[model samples]
Target: MSVDDGILEHMFESDFASADDKTVVAAIEECARAEAMLAARRLAATAELTARYTEPDEDRDHLAVDGWRMASAEISAAMRVGDRAASSQMCIAMALRERLPKVAALFAQGRLSAALVSTITWRTQLIVDSQIAQRIDTAIAQRAGEWGGLSVARLESAIDSLVDQHDPDARRRMREAAQNRDVRLGKRDDVTGTMSLWGRLSIADGELLKRRLAQLSSQVCKDDPRTAGQRRSEALGAIAANAEGLSCRCGSPDCPSAGQDDPRAAHFVINVITEANAPNTEPVPATPAESATAERAAGPVEPATEPQAAEPATERSKPRSAAALIIGGGLIPTPLLAELIKNGAKVQWVHKPPAAPETGYRPSGKTARFVRMRDMTCRFPGCTRPAEFCDLDHTTPSPAGATHPSNLKCLCRIHHLLKTFGGWGDQQHPDGTVLWTAPSGRTYFTHPGSRLFYPGWDTTTATLLVPTGPARHGDKGAMMPRRRRTRAQDRLRRIERERALNAIDRKRWAAPATTQPSRPPPQNDDPWKITTDANIDTTDTDPAPF
Candidate 1:
């Protein structure tokens, strides 16, 4: 029988239930080896496909824009993955094929797991010299089979040490990470009216923000019921809305901060869409003072602040018992929604979609807002980037593609680049549906993300008819934007700069301390300063009698 037939027969014939513990353990090891071999095969195939699409020309470097065009898109379609993921896979595949042949061989021999290979490739990516890379690869492969038990952190450190030994400059030193500091608001999860905050800030800025939050949290009266964490969260919100301070909820009549108008009260505008006659749709009192007094009479209450606008909610005329939708936040509980409106929050109603598509090349504000509300996220398949952060791409290049809602769709910058230069094409339909054609000729269909949340609302628009002819913005002579410095050049410069800084620190640390010279005796003043062997007193040999 062929190898495939034999493997299938063995797979069916295995009787794990009848096996002893030793046999079970051996079987598990065999399965792990098989998994590694399978992963190697997958990477090999990916490498082959990438080579086919991104073959280099003698006149131009493969690293240039032209060679990699459409390569990632092809991989993305074949693997049914996002563009970023496909590009990462391609990088790993190329690294194995061209730079780390020894490690790749170990992977193919079922001795190294996929995770280990990934870590090894990433840790050694800075080694620009092929000779050094090969040396490190061989060194790693020789012992990688014994590293199955190592955690991810340990594995990375082990690989890094090897690279550092061979080429100290190539060691991955990411001191520039502070330059990438950012803050992000997470999508709402199951928690009602709450979302998580995530951020990476400079050390100084982070400490400052933390101290500021703590100070604000302490502004509340001692009897406030909220926990420290909750108080901090409220304080962050207060800072975001430019509010004066958190209101004290101690229910004390003589509280000093009572009756003070919140400067932030008018700044908070909440957009909520609800059925006009929906039950329990009571509005909060018109003023913060009135709302606070009412809550006090009812006993201690949860801290209240003006609600920020919910992301645009789906408009529906029919009455239903569904909870109110906060535009960007998520679902708000009915009681909480009522309380927010009572706390001097401004309410704006979104009753319907934009009336019509605009005539200008750029979409009007109304059209842009409507598109964001309808799509909710990027229209690219498997991409979940929020529409608010995406560019409104023209399905067909503009002028040929009108500024109509049907022709405009949300695409994050990366995916937008793919459609523009990566040989990917897309069609946008009247109902916010997108049909994508990747470089590999596979097609994917995606609908407006809002359809999943607001099923009853209509997102349909006027149908756009694509003109039949050559594209106005064809990619005949297109080139991907070149970087100021290539990745290899940038890596070399960064390594040199960082190593020089390190050398300065090392020299300072290792240098011997300077000693002050002994002062000379004053001229003709102290005879004890000069000593000679003859001047020693032999009479002192006898012990002194006391």
Candidate 2:
């Protein structure tokens, strides 16, 4: 039987005063289901429409852009949505149609919501093997309703777990993808002179940056009113200025303030997780540029011929510089890494597994730095406010909650208050992800920003490795003050240069030893020569005869 419109009207108007607790709760859940049903219908229509459009307008016009791109452009123009968003939606729709028939059926029936199915569709594609993908599809379809309440992090983790369990090569695939990390620095804008930064980083390199930034961010002056982000911005500028003052103009990582006035600034650390095991015959080039050039110059790098495969695994830790590329996520450029090594960067191998649990109400300065470095930013859903500006919230609540790194999280002031007073609830996992529950019971999750891309990162080596390099480019071994050139020496050099130039000028103007070529005597008699009166030498008796 169809419920009367008057019932919903009454539910909204009465605020559930006339209804029991069960009735109100049931009504809310049913409403959510209805909305999800509507979304499912819309996505189904979208899939059908996209399927028909094998060639979009741009394709017919000889623009090789994807068909969905043209559709996204039109959608953006008509609906005021971003083109990127539109294209993504179109892609999801097509993927669901082709790869996820069970999910598509569930969505059509409104048993599974479009949003939740989209999350499943997107993540399941990570399983490269079709058999593994089918297994995951079956697993998710079996628990469709249960998966709906899961937060995004939980859902992704669940999918990743299944893939790893089913696919033997999952770890290899992840490491291969991680190797493709890169950093991009955008051009400064004309109006603001501000550029954007975005990149993929290996966990080790990214953690180092966070630790450095946190240490620098803490160097605030009294009466400073700048925001946390502003402080970090200034700290970045200070890094450059500090290096400049050390006269370390060589843009090299090894020389990054190699010989510096400040010992503290010269010290840094990095963790060497693993090293390349090349045979004793040919060593690998240290930098990417050198590797490329060597490949070209040497006509492709030859593999190590003699295998020391007989060598024990224990010998790998001895470390004879096969390049640090494996550990830094390929994000740090070859030049920078070479410079760091050049300046005596302190290299430490990661041997520890994980940090011991701590139990304090308030975190120590050291703990706070580590937590900030680990988290990198606020741990609220979709909130990217830097952890520097955030409060360290106890995920389980303080006093009753232990002061462990696993228990603590960075929450911006606004979110901290919302969790403290607002109807939101959260639970932190051992892996540092937070499962957040809204007042209405919708679940979401936030994870430590730095560690997201690298799931298999060595937790023991998560702590930063500081490279105690030289203070300046030339400052190797001991720190020594360079002697200044005296004014007398400068003057003497200038005098010598002046004398050398004067001697050259005098020699250039001196007369030749050989006699100058003699002019033909009286060529005017030869009509063929056509000598003019002016051409006749005036020096020769005034050319009177001519």
The best candidate by lDDT is 1
List TM-scores for all candidates, in order: 0.70, 0.34
**Cα error, candidate 2, residue 387 (Å):** 31
- The best candidate in terms of TM-score: 1
Q: Which portions of model 1 show Cα errors greater than 4 Å?
A: 1-35, 48-70, 73-86, 173-207, 250-357, 474-482, 486-488, 491-546
Per-prediction count of colliding residue pairs? 6, 21
Task: Give the residue spans of candidate 2 off by over 4 A.
Answer: 1-17, 55-62, 77-79, 126-136, 161-233, 237-546
- Which 10-residue span in candidate 1 carries the lowest summed lDDT? 293-302
Per-residue error for 9 in candidate 2, Å, reads: 10
User: lDDT (CA) for every model shown?
Assistant: 0.68, 0.53
Residue 246 Cα positional deviation in candidate 2, in Å, after optimal superposition: 16
Model 1 per-residue lDDT tens digits across residues 155-257: 8888878887898766765546885788988653646667778879999999999999999899888888899999898888779767768877676778865
